[model samples]
Target: MIEGRMETRTAILRAARTLFLERGYAGASVRSVASAAGVDAALPIHYFGTKQALFLEALPSMPDYQPLLEGDPDDLGERFVRYVLEEDGHLRPLYLTLLRASDAGAVGEQLRDLHETTFVAPLESRLAGQDAELRARLAAAVVGGLMYALWVVGDDQLLAKGEDDIIRRYGALLQHLIDDRL
Candidate 1:
């Protein structure tokens, strides 16, 4: 009975991920995801409490940024770019999903909270001097824009550039934002 419940929960989460990716937050409903998982609509609510909670659970876990933070400050930018482009490549689809659903009420709030906890807060802690919050947010924007351009928009020019070239160029920009004082 316990195993069965776990299976049902996993199925719901899996279905939620698929539907959320395909239809965005506003379009995908608990009923639809439950149907996709072959479960009753109430099951999702019973297990996850809310659609927003289910959506958050369905997202892939974020890559650890500790290594980048712990690394030499001089190389932090390049490390971060490489980490996102290579190590966290699998998260591109998830990022796209989040971007698509970002404007939805609950999802938008959750996204902001996630961003603050996952990116801004951690980076801000490491930053020194004035405008640390602004700098952290700027760095996050650079990464977000890169993901949008490369994965979402599929920019030809950016795609044409070798990964190394992008790392070197964008890395410098991120490094400046991270290390420069306001």
Candidate 2:
């Protein structure tokens, strides 16, 4: 019974993650999650109490990005850029979901909180300037804009550039932000 319950929960969560990413919080419905999970619609409510709770539960644990930050100051930008560009990176989907769901009330608030705490806070701490937090946020905006162009907006011109060229050029931009030289 316990094993079956666990399987059901896992199925529900997997379905929820995919739907949340595909449809965002506003569009992903419990019935749809249940349909995707091959379970009854009520199953999610039984397991997670609410769609918001289910969404939170379905959110993957973020991978540690500290290695990117721990490298030499000069190389930190390249490292961070490369980490974000890695093939089949896991965090991208989570990030996309967060961005898409960011205006959906409580779930959006939680996603923003998770993003700031998990990703931005550490970067802010690494900065040395006055208003380091603000600088870090601005850096996030730059990086986020680039990411949106590449991943969300599908900007083909940006995508056509060779990886190394993008790294060298954009890495400098990121470096300037990280160093608080911007």
Candidate 3:
């Protein structure tokens, strides 16, 4: 019985990730995920509590930015850019999923909260200046655009460019913000 329950939970989670990716959070429903998983709709509710909870659970775990934060302040931008471009393959889907569903009602709220907590707040704490919050937000926006262009739109030109070039250019932009030069 325990094994059966575990399988059911795993199946539901797998289906949720697939449907949520294919159709944004607004479009993907517990019913649909349950259907895809071959489970009763109530099972998802029972295990995950709510669609928001399920969505959060289905997302890839957030990468730890602590190491990036601890690195040399001068190299923070390059570190961030390199981490996203090279090490954060698992996070691509999460960015797309959040972006696509951002305009939806509760998901919008969730996205805002996630953005603040995950990206803005930590970076904000590291920044020095009266406009630290604004700078962090601006940097976050650049990161978002980069992810969207690379993963969602699949910009061929950008994709064709070497990673080093992107790291240098984007890193400088982020570094400017980090340094409060802008």
Candidate 4:
């Protein structure tokens, strides 16, 4: 029963994410998420309490970073660069939706909290004792910048380039900086 419930919750989150991304948060509705999840509208409310809560639950999963970082952290810089450049097209929609929703004040606070807790705090912990604050800020900036750049690339043809090419060209520079600095 517990496992089934967990799966249902996960499904709701996944569906909510897809719908929220497809139709900005303001455009997405509980009914849409429920229909996407193949569950009734009340189920999402029962599991997540609100659409904002559902969006927050799905935020961490948006970038799908686990596979990229699951292996050796030693090659993280290259892998990170590759992951974003390759997967950016698929991931940009979510970021666009989130940014729009965030700007609209629909989910700004929750998004900020999610970012601070999940990304900033973790980066701070990892870089502790080695210019912790600066490192944390840099890490956040790099990640956010990468996402934003990818978003821009979606609309701007002048920035056209493949993921592997981007990684091959700039990965070493970025990696060296990260490695040498920390």
Candidate 5:
């Protein structure tokens, strides 16, 4: 019974994540997620309370390249960039959902709180040796810019070339901006 429940929860989350990314909060309904998950419409609400809650539950709570953060900073940057360029990178979908939600006042505030608490806090911890707040903010800006550029440009040519290429180009640019400013 417990195993079956867990499987259903996982399915709901998977469906919710996909639909939320594809349709944003406004367009994605609890019914839609439940249908996608092959469950009753009320299943989402029963498991997660509300559509917004389910959406947050489905969002990436951490970057997928967490192990890289435990290694060298340079290596981390390369791995992070590579992960970003990879098909269906965890960060990209969440980033897109948040960006889309930002247009709705209440949803935007909710997204901001969720991001600052989960996303930003983790990155800030990774930047601890680099003067904490400054490094974190700089890193956030760089990531935001890169994500926005990738979304707008609709191509990963620059990102897909190689991790070495991303590091040599964007990493150097980011390091100069942050290190010099610090």
Candidate 6:
């Protein structure tokens, strides 16, 4: 019985993630997750209480960024871009879900918090000289734009660029932001 309950919970979480990514928080219903999980609709409610709760539960934990930060500072931007592109399919839905959330709501706040903790703070620490925070913000903005342009908007010209070209070109731009002086 305990095993079955655990399995059911796992299934619900997986289903919730897929549905949330596919349909967004507002778009993904408890019923839909339940259906996908092969459980009764009440089961999700029983486990998670509310759709918002379930959405939070389903959010992917941030991967350790330490390794990505370990390399030479000059290549950091390229490394970052490589990491971003390597993640291709995984992060698309995450950002998509963020966009789907209402800016004034709980989900939006959660996403914002995640962005700062998982992104900005780390970069701020790495950056040196005047206006580190501003530099970090600009660098983070470029990263966000790359994600939106390549994955979210699915721009052909930008997406079509070879990995080496991106690492050479976009990486340089990001690095410039990271080294901002004024």
Task: Provide C-alpha RMSD values for all models, in order.
Answer: 2.3, 2.0, 2.6, 4.7, 4.0, 2.1
Candidates sorted by TM-score, descending order? Answer: 6, 2, 1, 3, 5, 4
TM for candidate 2 is: 0.87
lDDT of 4 by residue, 87-177 (tens): 6466667667778788645478866776677556654554425566565556557766777865744535424666566676555645544
Per-residue lDDT tens digits of candidate 5, residues 1-182?
99999999999999988898888877898888999999988989999887777877787665544465566765455555555666466667777788887776656777667657654566667663547766756766776677787885666776577657765677666554334444
| 89 Cα displacement, candidate 4 (Å) | 7.3
lDDT of 4: 0.68
TM per candidate: 0.86, 0.87, 0.83, 0.62, 0.68, 0.88
**lDDT agreement with native, every candidate:** 0.87, 0.81, 0.86, 0.68, 0.71, 0.82
Query: Whose TM-score is greatest here?
Result: 6
Q: What is residue 129's positional error in candidate 6, in angstroms?
A: 1.0
* Model 4 stretches astray by more than 4 angstroms: 1-15, 34-48, 58-75, 88-93, 104-106, 124-130, 152-162, 180-182
Better of 2 and 3 by TM-score: 2
Q: Model 6: runs farther than 4 Å from truth?
A: 1-4, 102-104
Clashes of each: 0, 0, 0, 0, 0, 0
Output the lDDT of residue 59, model 5.
70
How big is the positional error of residue 1 in model 4, measured in Å on the Cα after superposition? 13
For 1-182, candidate 2 gives per-residue lDDT tens digits of: 99999999999999998898778777899999999999998999999998888988897776676776666867777777777777466777777787877776777778677668766898887777687888778777877777888789888887579778888888899888778786
lDDT of 1 by residue, 1-72 (tens): 999999999999999988987787778999999999999989999999988889988977766677678778
lDDT of 5 at 54: 81
Model 6 agreement with the true structure over 75-124: per-residue lDDT tens digits: 78888888887885767778778777746367777887887898789888
Q: Please give the distance, in angstroms, between residue 131's alpha carbon in candidate 5 and its true position after superposition.
A: 5.0
| Model 1 alpha-carbon miss at residue 119, Å | 1.0
4 versus 5: better lDDT goes to: 5
